[model samples]
Target: MTASSLTRPSSKASACGCGMKRRAFLRTTFAALCLPSLARGNGPSPLPSFDRCLEHFMAARNIPGGALAILRHGRLVYARGYGWAQREQQIPVQPTTLFRLASLSKPITALAILRLAQARRLSLDEPAFDRLGLAPLPGKTRDPRLEHITIRHLLQHTGGWDRAVSGDPMFMSHPIARACGVPSPPGPRDIIRYMMGRPLDFDPGTRHAYSNFGYCVLGRIIEAVTGHPYETWVRRDLLTPLGIRSMRLGRSQLRNAHPGEAHYYMADNRTAPSVFEEVPSVVPAPYGSFCLEAMDAHGGWLASVVDLMRLSAALPGHGGSLLTAEMWQELVRPPAPPVARDAHGRLNDMYYGCGWLVRPIQTPPGHNIWHSGSLPGTFTFWVILSNGMAWAVLFNQRREANGLPDTEIDGLLHLAAAHVQEWPESDEFPRYYRPSS
Candidate 1:
């Protein structure tokens, strides 16, 4: 679609407002144009059947609810909710419904660190432990490599700990709490102390293995440098300027659920030992199977599709990115002599850059950057296409038996995008959105 076609008049309506005049006009116009093209066999149809695509996928996969938002050429072209947000309560998944972002939290945290770096408050190459005012825990074998671990290493997932061998220390909430002499569910600080006493899985910066603990350490570094909680600094420095207000760190207990947050549904509906001993014998995995609060930097964020899109719009290519152009370049630049590759010896098309996954596109002038987040009850996917398009999809229930739901959703989005002959000229943000309180 042409850029002019996507332009829309701005509005000041509340985010949760139900202004549907533009929506109705676009639907009617889109349908009318598609009918003539089919009858004349003029060319491929331009109409994107997003609703049908999403409905079919949700039904086939048994997904209770989801929300989708799409932006083309830096303008929101499609934003809608499907199915239920809270099945038991009969709450529909509107654009305003909050859902756990899981690991997508890393990108937000990474941006905060980059912001600090831009301000000269911290250096990316400095030894992270020294900067954080932390030393190896007293009784554990001190790996000399720990001293060489820099903030860059942590951001790149090269800080040494590997989940395949030593296990992800972030997920071992109970053991970390017990070993650190704390309560049942240890927080980020406790987890860091527990891991510091352990040996590195590999020498720092030698290999690339995805590590949630690495991001956890980055969060600590943010706190150490800023003297403020990670979330607080992020809100002030990164999100506030972007007009995002509702995103917040999620709580593990259902009772503490944020207003308008979707209810989680695990396929098994099984319970695990409570993270808090004082609680019931068991609780739903999303609520207490592990400590969501402790997973703050890596996986504990709750946000709506609108919140995520706002972040995407602020990234480097979208013209309104928060970081300076120089800093933004540094954030996306792949490590020199790229160390990541797959078994076939082909240069891995996709590699982790700062917080997001980077995949170079041969056909497109720019690369694609995206992230996927999955937990017991949540599955989320967000992408910034090389063509200046971005979108986010979030689901309350994840299917264990079905093939990877995010991958299927990814293809579905591409299919829908391919069929779009025209994009709405007006943004629906103000009419249909209600800012998170």
Candidate 2:
């Protein structure tokens, strides 16, 4: 899939639900999944300590605002926001603020697929065409290997589908069908047809490479099996089950979303305020490109730090919601050995597990799995150490394309990882300059 193909529809489409019955079911499920601490907490507020770090970091990098969430042992221990969510409007960011997850939305979509798989609604080995009954594209590659393409292939980024990177013709002022060479940019049904038109980059099981097309296909499959639109199925079945109420799946919903939502920014460089785009709705496809929308299934979920935590904490062995324990294990387990990476000379190898980029971190205690998301003006990362440590960092500035090295953001994350502790402390702040004792 091209970048544009990742856009999801705006939330304008009603999810495939019967009526008040579905709404009541969703509300009850949401109530059941509520986190332990969301409502009441007298523990030291996370704000004061995080405020110091965020203020310093933003000033140092010239980013207007950001948010971070940390969960320890499945409880939301911290959620903090800083800077201007709306710089032009002079609005300040608050802890409850929301932002588009961009590619980070993939994990959520992946979870929805897994939830279906656990229910035996589909199987990993189910052929893509059979699962969705999607037709093959005309004049596309006729490789029989595609018959072996499973839901798992889509999750692991090993589907061998080609991605047209670096352009937004789908977002340009042109017809979607003409912009993309297919007869018509097939809705959820056409993704596989589009892929059938292309030859495999490598045999499906061999090595690994990132392909948004694989994910887009998976999203389509979810909709097909659930008899619901991609966003509705995900929100009703997945997010609601996890008690994540603030998150939304498509751009139309985002545009009409309430005021507390954070706006998106595009950076020209690292040290300046980002140019904001406040479109009423997003075009979802090719997740990282263009603005937000509800067109693509593989990406486009807008969320808050708490919502991301709801997801991040939910995947560690399922713990009685959404996916089953066995399915969650399959999600976190190491991928096929051949695809593991040791590129940094790190002792442990990493692979992509269903819907997640699995990296085994070499920390003193052992290793942890981690994934990071980078969109136009925002970048976020999360790590869940098997030993029960989870930390996340989210930013609202895109510094790399604007002549600023990505190291600036990396540096902040590195600092956070080094200094982060379970206990809040004023002394935890690293002094920018220390006077002589």
Candidate 3:
């Protein structure tokens, strides 16, 4: 995507929510809704002023359509769709439309683990091997550093393991069992078994890096300790309390609830036929893989913009509904002081805090705490403010475009974040964040 593509029109139209003039608003709205023959389909209502934003994005990239949901303070002030939910049949996206959340599902999964921690069923600092029943293996070829890895380390990515050697096929492949020295994959106890056997990448707590492996292990612990499937626990403990009816585990739930799901896209040229090829109706491989287990403890869940915004606002601290105030505070607080980011959001050395991406908020006066996620054809960005303000942006077209040479979704987020202003109090906007009861 080009800088020009990202640039929002300076002029305002009266009919547009951002206060643009009528003719301009109509043109912008039309552009936002316009889609190619392959992309055309029905979609939900347009968000209040998103006409310009969606128009600019869709026109530049040839994207089919997408959903945008905005929250001011704690309330969902706006949600709208720009393109078709099902392009072939021309099904429009609605407020309830479901999209594969990709890695954004991590925070939800992390929430389940955190809830367990709050209940004292598990401790973040305790050794996960024995607790999850992976201790006392045959050769104990496990990383010496592995012994030191804890639930907290996994949550924060301080576990010292690294990304896969070549393909990073942690999700698509079943080698975790081989790497961790465990038996087969795809069983309830696979993660614990694998972690107990694999060699350590480095000493626990020595450094910070992202690790899906860490969360995968933690997921096993959740089930072992809770005596329920990870998804079942999350639904009963977290989703139910928060009124998040739209979220579901794996592709099966999505297919069942959303037969009219939106089509996901990659940059036309970058994708091979094998990748862009349609996924069969049959559910595919490694059940709890990141892409598959989104509803699991690690990441493969599906949800809508409205539900995501709701989760963002609630924050769910303590014994309260979304998160206890203390948990929320802990979530946004600076990590153990390697002091990664200074006041600005720039990272010198950053680390994860529980499920959040811990970095400086980087406004005039710096704040901290934010998380961003990207996957094949989806992108999601979010920021949670200490003073009770939060914002999220979810867009569905993936791009590996010319010249810029990286993901276009990042550019989309930068554009959205640039125009976003703090939700101002007025009768026109509704308050979505109510304290968790």
Candidate 4:
């Protein structure tokens, strides 16, 4: 269906047999789903108003470009693009237009590690450095805690590097390069070497702090175990198996942009020094201010909304085809207690599982899994509801003002889902899956 059709009422009547308007029926059904008793009923929950709600949300936020895709029971129900992928050229965003996944790259990397474990290539509980045939970077005061860091710790963001205090080591490209005797912008391996010599912010597994460096280390571990580049292995093993062809590691320069990639925009229209000194003095933040290539496992993949939803569907909760059943259970399993509690001393509503953040619901179906990613000029959010429904939204411009943009998106999506009454039976995947010229 066309983007315009998403806002109009369908000719088909409500399947609920009440002769109710599609929108009203959807709103009522979704409201019922919120109740614990009705949640487990084997009824359909379609999101028909998704396109209209997303269009309104983007316009209100002045988002330059975006793509959204929704899935029901692993089937594509809604997929559309909005605004302009390149405003200067008047290029409208298409469903196939690729946008940077940003930190969403973590989940993909986490999947790779889990797959490796399934193949008996590595153990999650083993010391990561030992498995990689490396040692912690030598520091003045040797901290024995480094030896306790495991693959599971890195996946759960409990590897001890706190961005709040010591800052994200992944962004310290120049300093890492200088310290490791690498080129001006250090690669993942060089960054790992530089961080090894430093003391961890806290004891391993003591607390959860988002760490890009931890995933960067995971990338290297993938390389070490497979004896192949992280991207090469992921593309060959994880993505291609699911028929995802366009996802790949992104570049830091527009000139190096992959085919069908959208041009990124910053909210302030500001530029920063390029990661490569030899390049232009200043470049768009998404294009070159940071080294995306070095950000391999943490935040560097570029993908279309369709591809992301496909990945989501392949995940365990939604009857995924990727990991084995046992592996899937392990992926969503929460860290063992005394589980880390929030500041209020209450159990966190959500905890970072292997790669995704999981929030268990008191109602039926148990839990929901999701991941949100952001970089200088990109914002992406992916969520898989407990009832085998999944959706993903990717935007080229990320607004960095007061609160988190993705959190607002989560609210908007909930509103949209609640308002949806009838769903289009036709799948738009075949129509928009191919790249546009």
Best by TM-score: 1
Q: Give lDDT tens digits, candidate 3, residues 137-212.
A: 4665665666677777777777767664322333433455455444333343554454556566667776666776
Candidate 4 structure quality by residue, lDDT tens digits, 1-437 = 00000111112323113344657745643454344321111253244356555655565567888888898876788777778889999888888899999888988999999999999999999998775665445553445777899999999888878888998877777777777666767887777767777888998888888888899999989999999999999998888877788999999888888888998887788888777867887877777788889898999898999998888777766667689988887787877544458666677766778988777766674667778788887888887777767888899887667343344556557666655677667765676455332
Give the candidate number with the greatest lDDT.
4
lDDT of every predicted structure (CA atoms): 0.75, 0.55, 0.55, 0.75
Better of 1 and 2 by lDDT: 1
lDDT of 1 by residue, 324-396 (tens): 8888766766753335766665566567778877766666456777777888898887788777888888888
TM-score of each: 0.86, 0.71, 0.72, 0.85
lDDT (Cα) of model 1: 0.75
- The 10-residue segment of model 1 with minimum total lDDT is 1-10
Off by over 4 Å in 1: 1-48, 342-346, 362-364, 432-437
Q: How accurate is candidate 4 locally (lDDT)?
A: 0.75
Clashes of 4: 4
In model 4, the runs with Cα more than 4 Å from the true position are: 1-48, 135-142, 342-346, 402-404, 430-437
